[model samples]
Target: MTPAFSLAGISKRYPDFSLRDVSLTLPEGQVMGLVGVNGAG
Candidate 1:
């Protein structure tokens, strides 16, 4: 089966933090969420 959503080699940078080489996949009929603290971005 194919993925409904996909991410590869994703990266994010901030003055105080960073997200490097992040990857994710979501299949069909699925849900995803990113929960963090108030200051997280």
Candidate 2:
């Protein structure tokens, strides 16, 4: 099996928001959903 989507060693740094070592995977014939909200800055 292979991953349809993936992220490795991903990092983001900021004065307000930060994401580190984020990873994800979606197999074949699968659905993915991403939901998020951003506050006013």
Top candidate, metric lDDT: 1
The Cα RMSD in angstroms, rounded to one decimal, for candidate 1 relative to the true structure is 2.5
Q: What tens digits encode model 2's per-residue C-alpha lDDT throughout 1-41?
A: 99877778899999998999988778888996776565332
Clashing residue pairs in candidate 1 are none
| Per-residue lDDT of model 1, residues 1-41, tens digit only | 79999999999999999999999999999987776797464
**How high is the CA lDDT of each candidate model?**
0.91, 0.81
lDDT assessment of candidate 2:
0.81
Regions of model 1 farther than 4 Å from truth: 39-41
User: Candidate 2 regions off by >4 Å?
Assistant: 38-41
Q: Alpha carbon lDDT of residue 29, candidate 2? A: 88
lDDT of 1 at 3: 97
